[model samples]
Target: MVFKESFWTLSFDGAAAGGKGGTEIVLTRKSGEKLYLSYKLDFHCSNNEAEYEALIWGLIAAEKHSIKKIQIQGDSKLIVKQVSRQFVLKEPVLATYRTTIQRLLDKFQKFEIEHVPHSDNKFSDAFTTLGVRVDIPEEEVTIVIKKRTEPSIILENKDLPKDLREKILE
Candidate 1:
């Protein structure tokens, strides 16, 4: 069978705070397009469960998008190794997760999972920092849950004529 030349990149990260947890999935296409999804876990779960949920959801999304080749990355070493079949799963819950992930893996023409350091996975890290509240000095807690198509710093400001700018603004 001829393999496709295109591939998509997938990354996942999970965060837990005050008995609450969430997962983030970021998918990047070869054309520099990206899709980000973040969900807050309603039930109680450890960090590992959240990570697996992220991976599973990400894979499902790839299937929906008809992606045939994928390179998966995650900060969770155990989940990555287990999914890659490089490490044995000891926990029953994680074993179940692995089974689900394996079933999804069959849908792809080619796929690989790698363990990456948290520092190198800054985009996923940023998603985990969502839904967090930080106190600014003595003021109220500021909730930060940013979901943007482009990074705020890199956004381009097009200089349109005054008339056009006024019409667009209106």
Candidate 2:
């Protein structure tokens, strides 16, 4: 069940004016033994909506990069609830975004959305606060990879050149 080569993290953040709240998002995937993908977007929208959009855009980016398995990390509890099927879609505003996310889920071999407290998502918060956006999305995200593993056979599989598998045999 090793997915991701190294660790590719994707982060998206957003903010809203007047009454809306800001949002921050992060998605991480591993590329063999290196990390190549991480994104952060800060913009304005309803708090819930912004959260949804962050997740949406993050998935779009991951798909664009051809990521097969993704573990989505977020700071909003409500967003995680909705995405993980724990809460029902009561608000109509989320319907569209939920649809978009559902489609993305179909593209990955494994997808799991986890909820972390805002404290745990400090980096993502800082990213969104650094001038959040309302209409446009930011593409400035930091992606770092550790030393490449020469014997990363899991990543060598032709079908999985982009495959990132991490495992610890007991």
Best-performing candidate as measured by lDDT: 1
* CA RMSD, predictions in order: 13.2, 12.4
TM-scores across all candidates? 0.73, 0.62
RMSD of 1: 13.2
Q: What would the TM-score be for candidate 2 when compared with the true structure?
A: 0.62
168: Cα error in model 1, Å: 39
Pick by TM-score: which candidate is best? 1
lDDT by residue (tens digit), candidate 1, 1-170: 99556889999887666655666888899889988776555455667877887787678778878899999999989889888888888888677677778887899999988999988988787767563222123233222222222111111124556675334222
Question: Which residue pairs does candidate 1 place in steric collision?
Answer: none
RMSD, model 2, all Cα superposed? 12.4
